[model samples]
Target: MYVALFESSHGAVLQPLDESGLATGEARDVGASGLAAAVAELEAGHPRWVWDDTSRWYPRLLAEGVRIERCVDLRLSHAILRNSALTASSTLARSAASSWDRAAPETVELTADAALFDFDGPAQLNSAEDTLAEFALQRAAIAGAADPARLGLLLAAESAGALVAAEILYAGLPWREDVHDAILARHLGPRPAPGVRPAKLQAVLERLREALDAPTLNPDSPPELLKALARAGLIVRSTRSWELKKLTHPSIEPLLEYKKLARLLSANGWHWLDTNVRHGRFHPEYVPGGVVTGRWASKGGGGALQLPKQIRSAVVADPGWKLVVADASQLEPRILAALSGDRGMAEAGAAGDLYAGIVASGAVATRDQAKVAMLGAMYGATTGESGRLMPALTRAYPRAIGLVETAARAGEKGEIVSTRLGRSSPPPGPVWRTSQSEAYGEGATDADVSRARGQARSWGRFTRNFVVQGSAAEWALCWMATLRGTLDELGDGAWLTDSPHLVFFMHDEVVVHCPADAAASVEAAVRESAAQAGRLLFGAAPVTFPLTVAVVDDYGQAK
Candidate 1:
């Protein structure tokens, strides 16, 4: 059953629908303040809720201590179907932008203090009728898809990801402020006041100034520092660590140290802790499907996706709880193994270390070489040592390499390539098409041809990686959804933080915060869900997606 939620005069209208989103029963009306109780009661039926935006509606229930099992986020689902190659012929895909395709809210926080659902005139689909109509359209699109099962699974996984993102946001990661402060102080002396640098950073700056012989040099100023480096006869293009490392000047060490420390101070320093971490939790707002490849992205605050290793130790578990961190091992490579039906590649990953298995299989002389060659194949590398090792990799894993090579060729020809689940690459832009056209036109300049070729190769590389990365993302989502459902079942009727819930999710890594007693069960669920996700994506496929599971007291010890 699908229960659609919409804005009513002073509350919400819940219309229960069948699998295809057609009304099957009488609707229920609930007020703004009582919405949480209404949803909690409805949980008995286990109906998948349908809402315009999960970010807009679910937070209130979470805030009220209510949790729903499943949901269909219209906005996210619309984005997928609209661009999906499988649903190209459907009305929803062909139609222009509508309210169902609205962007993510500026602030994802929608408390119970306001109306149950935010309304924006008739332009947005906030009314009950409009919401139901949109749901019907989405169902029609999925039903008419070339591969309905695959597209439906994609939508389900995507929506589940939305729910997971919101839940994780509410159940913020446990943070240790004192530990963070200690880490900062150890690396960067005492925390500096206001705009001043820390003592250690100041010392490094002094060394840099002394080495460059620029008495007033500001290491923070890239242009000024580059000028000083040039004056010291070290001509470099930029202040990037890699470029600076090429020149072994006495200033190089201090300059790199300054850059590292300054980055830490700026990105995740004391101010960041004060702003993002609240009440001993780092509440990050995650935007699911934020990246074009369907990967998640953190909003302005939190810096959740880019949590620096310098402060990872601060991600501590509560006293009675433990952090269960598990990252799928070599996820993309394993995804490629399944997507291509390459038995050799699948066999290489069967041992849990794909690169090592490849070396053992005589694909490459060393594990490092196998890794570099496999990466080169997936990323369309045609030069350097990685490129040189590609022939051996291709010979060993023909189907796997061939799959990416075909995707790269399609991309070079300005055609679309899709992942196993149906999320297709966007078409070449008008400018790119024009460049390709001009390069082949009469009297085309050599420079134009060269530029067009370079652009084609660049796009080819992106498509080559996209199929694997995007499919890997789908696999990760399925894993999370499966893990979430199993954990929910194991919760024995508890909600949110009271149960084993996901606290953090990176691209391929997921961290669950659970009671010490449930840690072992959660670890088992994590491994079980990984196996299930592979089967869901590639039924009976031999690819083994192994995970490195860690039950640790802090995130720093997870790896």
Candidate 2:
């Protein structure tokens, strides 16, 4: 059963729908403050809530102490169905663009005491009638899809992801500001006054200037620093750390050190601490389906995705809790194995480290060679050691290597490729199309042909990775969704906000904050979720998705 909730002019309205998504009753108004109670009552029937945006509606509901088992997030569902190649023949997929296609509304972080619903901000799904119509279209689109079951699973996983994102935000990650400050003080000296550089950074700057024999050099100015390096007879193209590392100079070490510290200060320094973290929690605004590959992105917080290893100590669990950190091991390569049905590669994945398995298969003598060769296969690498090792890898794992090669060749011909579940790569831009046309058309120069080939290979790299990355993202969504349900069931008598729950998710990693007593159960759940996700996608294929699960008191200790 589905219960659609929509914001109305007077208040909130709920309309019941049968399993087939047909309306069974007229809309009934539930006044603004009455939403929680209304939803609480509806919860007895275990109906899936259909709403415009999960980020907008679910957060407020969670704040009101209301948690629903399932939801059909219309905004997220529309995005997936509209762009999915599997749904191309559906009316909703071909429908003219509307406000629904717009990116989900920016999430507003609300304090617990703030108003539950802010109607005056902007009208979104303000009419039960419009919300119902959108839901119907989405259902019809799924029904008419080429592989409706697969697309339906994708949509369900995607919508569940939105709910998880909102809940993660509300729950917030456990953070220890004291630990963060101490880590900063140890590396950067004491926090300086506002607008002033830290003592350690200033000291490193001095050392850099002295070693380069340019007393007045401003390390922050790229052009000035580049000029100083040239003046010091270090003729490098750029000051990127990789290039700097190749050169042996007294200043190189300090310059690299200075850059590293600067990044930490600028990205997660004192100002970041004061602004983002509060009440022992770091509430990063998670944007679900933000990345084109379907990975989640974050906004309005310290580099959530790019948190530095040095500061990871700050991610301490609450006193009575444990952080259940688990990351899928070699996720993408394993995904490629399952996607291509490469029995050899799948067997490799089923064993421990896929690269080690490749070595054992005699594809390469060294693990590193196997690593680069597999990476080259997935990423379109065709140079030096990677290229040299590729043939062996291909000979050993023909199905896996051939799958990506076919994708690369298709991309080189300017054809779009779709992911396993049917997210198609966008066509090349007009400039690229024109360049290819000019290269092969009436008259062409060698330079024109060369440039076009280069462009094609570049695009090929993108498309080759897109399929594996996107499908891995789908697997991750299923993993998280399955784990979420498992955790909910484990903590049946307790509210999600007050019980063991997910607090953070990176691409292949997830951190669950749970009571110490439930730590073992959570670890089991994480491992079980990975197995379930693999089965959900590949259907008993030999490929195995293994997770490195760590139950620790601090996030840094997990690894």
Candidate 3:
């Protein structure tokens, strides 16, 4: 069952849709004030709600204490169908860019995804008729797709991700402002006033000045720092940390320390606390499908995804609750094994350490070499130790290695490569095509050939990893979506905050904020969902995804 919802001038409109996406009943009118109640009433039947964008609708519903079990985010689905190779022959993909293609809604600041008020964009398409038309096109595209099952799964997983992102936003991650402040103070001394460096940072800055013997040098300015270093017999191109680290100077250690502390101050300092955290929780704005490879990204200077490990100690559970942290072990490598049907690699991975498995197979002398070789294969590493061990790794796992090699060759020829579930890579842009074309022109120079060849190889590297990374992302979606449903069955499971709920999600890691008593159940659910996700993506491919799970009072202990 499905309910296609649209923004109505009077308030909102809901149309019942069957499995085929055809309307099964008349449109039901809902006032803006009564929207949440109306949604709750219909949610009782557990229909998969269809809407223009989950970002625009789900956040508001979640804010009003109304939670939904399933949804089809038309905006996200449109993106998939319009770009997927499986649906290339459909009218939806063949048509010119329409309003649906450019419909990211006007977002609120702190209430980022909570788009309660109506604001019109140039290409807004929220009418019931417009929504229905767009949805019908999506259905047609999926039905006409060469591999409808995989495409449909991709769409469903993408939409579910939208829901998960909104829910996490609404629920907010447990954060202790006081704990964050303590961590900062311990690293950088007391919090300084605006534009004033903390005591510890000031000490490092002074040391940098002394080491260069330039009393007036401002280390904060890159040009001044470079000139100072040059004048001190440390000639370097830039003040970048990596270049500076290679040099043996009294300034190097202090400079690196300064940079690290400065980053910590700027990214997660008192200002971050003032803006991000509220009432003991931090609400991070998540943009689903933010990465082209289908990974989630945070918005609005919160730096949620990039939360430095130094401040992880601040992520504390509530008094009577625990944070259940679970991360998949060797996710991408296992994904590669499953995708290629490499029985040997699969067997190696069963030991819970694929690299160890490679070493055990006599492919390499140690786990480190196996890791480097495997990373080289997946990431197109063609030099150094990785290159040296390539033949050995290849002999041990030919199918897995061959798969990435094939992807790399296809990419060099500017051909598109799809993930295991059919999320195709976008074609090269005009500049890339032009570069390759010019390299083959009659008057082409060696420089042109070299540049074009390098670019092709670089793009090949991207594609080689794209298949593995993108498919791994899909597996993550399935794991999270299934875990979400399982967690929904815990406790009352109706009011999101009352039950065990997901509070954070990294690429392959998830943190569930659960009551003390339900921690064990949530842990089991996390592992069970991982297994289920493996089966869903591979369908008995003999690859197992194991997770390292821990129930801790704070986030840092889980690691």
Candidate lDDT (C-alpha), each: 0.86, 0.84, 0.86
* lDDT per residue as tens, model 1, 474-515: 999999999999989778888778889898988899999999
Residue 119 in model 3: shift from native, Å? 22
* Model 3 lDDT-worst window of ten: 108-117
Q: Model 2: what TM-score?
A: 0.94
lDDT of 3 by residue, 324-384 (tens): 9999998999999999999999999898988899889888999999889989999899999
